[model samples]
Target: MSKKPNIIVAEDEEYNFALIRIIFEKEGMNILWAKNGEEAIEILNKNETIDLILMDIKMPVMNGLDATRIIKKINNNIPVIALTAYALPEDRAICMDAGCDEFITKPINRADLIKTAYKWLDQ
Candidate 1:
């Protein structure tokens, strides 16, 4: 059997992370939580097999943009999806410039989240 995809979610809000955890876990993906961008980097450093990252833009310790930049330097192949409350065009552009493979805004929709995840995971 193929191994389940492992995903790291970099989010500072407990409630948001919990919601995402519920959604991804239900889909049989292995979920790892990072409360900030720094923690996300730590997780990446330790776990070499992470398949994707759901990065929150406004994280406290280090913002998603900075983290994404660092992460891209580490592994450009692993897809990083930006999760933000900002839906402005500039926000999207900023995320893309920071090296995010995809962008998803806050108050995440269940179907869209799953579809996006599958798109990146090639499932």
Candidate 2:
């Protein structure tokens, strides 16, 4: 990438958003926060430079899976990683089917977050 990667985090919880912001900032990634998937879609529409998305599966207004499906239609090239409390295999499969490129269970692992970000950013 020519510039530092910009990541959109679609998380409703205040603490969760803060955690992701801190972690992403430490890695020199620009971060954008969306309180729900609706806001996420708005951001995606307004900002074409976003490099990746860390999506929360459960949110008011619109859920991540639904958002991912629409987002993929708009721009399938942007990689979206689903982050949710649900660790079930079915949940992962559903996220992938919805257009998420990767899945990570919460409470977010710092190492995993950094590694996943780097892996996708490099790609």
Candidate 3:
């Protein structure tokens, strides 16, 4: 990509967010960290240039599923990927139902994270 892709990572855990920030920053992507879904929504409303979102399903306030639903309503064109620790089939189904374009189970594989982001941003 010629321009750096701006991405929102909605996660509550500090350690998780830090790890993600380090990895994505290394890829030269512009990363915005949101502690909860509410903050994510706020950021989304303010920034129209965000290319993609990596949403953590389990958050303290407004979980990723609900956030994804609201986000789709605001901007359906932007891809939202569910990044969560839940690996069950039902979890994936729930994320899909909530408008997540993709699902990544934690602990996230570095290659998968980069590959998925590239796929969505490139498309």
Candidate 4:
């Protein structure tokens, strides 16, 4: 059996975070939520158990790109996937440059989202 993986989700939107939390919970994955980049970083720095991260791009205090950069510096082995409403090529490039492993646009497709998370967790 696959062991439960710890997922760190950073989303400023309350409803979005709740939806993701419900989905992951139903799938039997453990989750940690952060309302913004700073809080996400705090959680990450304090918790050594995170297996993967789903980071939202636009947020107050700090953004996902900045957080990804910092998190990568702290733990290069952990993977971070970017989630954003920005679907532009430049946006994707920016996320890539900041050290995100993948980019998934907002208004997320449920199957795709779950698949991406599971695939990374399996790896």
TM-score of each: 0.97, 0.97, 0.98, 0.96
Q: List the global CA lDDT of all models.
A: 0.95, 0.94, 0.95, 0.92
Q: List the residue pairs that clash in candidate 3.
A: none
RMSD of each: 1.1, 0.8, 0.6, 1.0
- Which tens-of-lDDT digit does each residue in 18-116 have in candidate 3? 999999999999999999999999999999799999999999879999999999999999999999898999989999999999999999789999999
Candidate 1: list runs displaced more than 4 Å: none
Could you tell me the C-alpha RMSD of candidate 1 in Å? 1.1
Per-residue lDDT of model 2, residues 8-58, tens digit only: 999999999999999999888899999999999999999979899999999
lDDT of 1 by residue, 1-112 (tens): 1789999999999999999999999999999999999999999999989999999999897999999999999999999999999999999999999999999998999999
lDDT of candidate 4 over 27-92, digit per residue (tens): 898999998999989999899788999999999999999999999999988889999999999999
What 10-residue stretch in candidate 2 is worst by lDDT? 1-10
> In what order do the candidates fall by lDDT, top score first?
1, 3, 2, 4
Worst 10 residues of 3 by lDDT: 60-69
Better of 1 and 3 by TM-score: 3
Candidate 2 residue spans exceeding 4 A from truth: none
Query: RMSD, model 4, all Cα superposed?
Result: 1.0
